[model samples]
Target: VPDITNVQVQINTGAPGYSPLETEQRITFPVETAMAGLPGLQQTRSLSRSGLSQVTVIFKDGTDIFFARQLINERLQVAKEQLPDGVEAVMGPVSTGLGEIFLWTV
Candidate 1:
């Protein structure tokens, strides 16, 4: 298990040149509702800007990264229809873990 971990989910409204404020208003409720009651989901923070929304899910220490991602994916799938047309949620890079970093001193 990694010492620290998080999963980032990005929601994008396919409508180009859309207003972030408007999009955020439409998505805020649905997205938050969708994220509720998910497993291993400790806390969530969200940001909305210019037709894009980002949510970061922080899990308790010792949670498996693979399971965390799977849980996120499943929840997002259920939330998809609730979002506006063309809106899509994507899971961020699984490889973002600090374990992927290498410190080498020569």
Candidate 2:
């Protein structure tokens, strides 16, 4: 496991083209709900809109998507029962182009 700081960012996707991204999403959260433990974390983004929710995942400098996906898949498999039904979660590429220019823009 690599060193990581716990960051949690809650984003509103419906806010005129809001896309999740690094640092912006890694703010802080409950221990179990964090992604630092998953490894190969280049970035993370969580989007909630119109009742739909999603997490955009990114890999680190030396990590590959396949490995990251596998780890995420296995964790989800184990957490299937723990998570509420109807909430579809999967590991997908984070769209940098969709990311915001800055962590915050007043």
Candidate 3:
């Protein structure tokens, strides 16, 4: 089995009461810039709406789960400082191949 890990980040796009589109526009640039050039990052998907910005990071196969989580957190730590005011980046739960158990064939 491949050792794959998923790291997700969520950030508040603006102060309370802002419109969703406005909030997304406010934080999109900085958030994208912050997550760029991350090591071991194989792919990234992002979503922004209703004052919420979420990013999912996928690491390459065989990447150490613990190390991958730590690496992502470290990059996010620095990115936090560069984010727009009132925006806070928070990491989601750690997910690895071992965390899944369902198998099916169709």
Which of the numbered candidates is closest to the native, going by highest lDDT?
1
Q: Residues 5-55, candidate 2, lDDT per residue (tens digit)?
A: 232222221222323332123221211254456776666665444344455
Screening candidate 3 with a backbone cut-off below 3 angstroms (N, C-alpha, C), the clashing residue pairs are none
Candidate 3 C-alpha lDDT tens digits along 21-106 = 66556655566666677677777777776767766666666666677667767777777777667767777665543445434321
Candidate 2 Cα RMSD after full superposition onto the native fold (Å): 10.0
Candidate 1, residue 27: how far the Cα is off, in Å:
2.6
Give the per-residue Cα lDDT of candidate 3 at 33.
69
Report, for every candidate in turn, its global Cα lDDT versus the true structure: 0.66, 0.44, 0.62
What is candidate 1's lDDT per residue for 1-106, written digit by digit as tens? 4445454444333435658786667665567678777776688877777767777677776678778778777877887888778667677666545544543321
Q: Residue 67: error of model 1 in Å?
A: 0.5
- How high is the lDDT of residue 68 in model 1? 78
Worst 10-residue lDDT window for candidate 2 reads 22-31
Task: Please give the lDDT score at residue 96 for candidate 1.
Answer: 47
lDDT of 1: 0.66
Which lDDT value does model 1 have at 92? 68
Which prediction has more favorable TM-score, 1 or 3? Answer: 1
> TM-score for each prediction?
0.72, 0.49, 0.65
lDDT of 3: 0.62
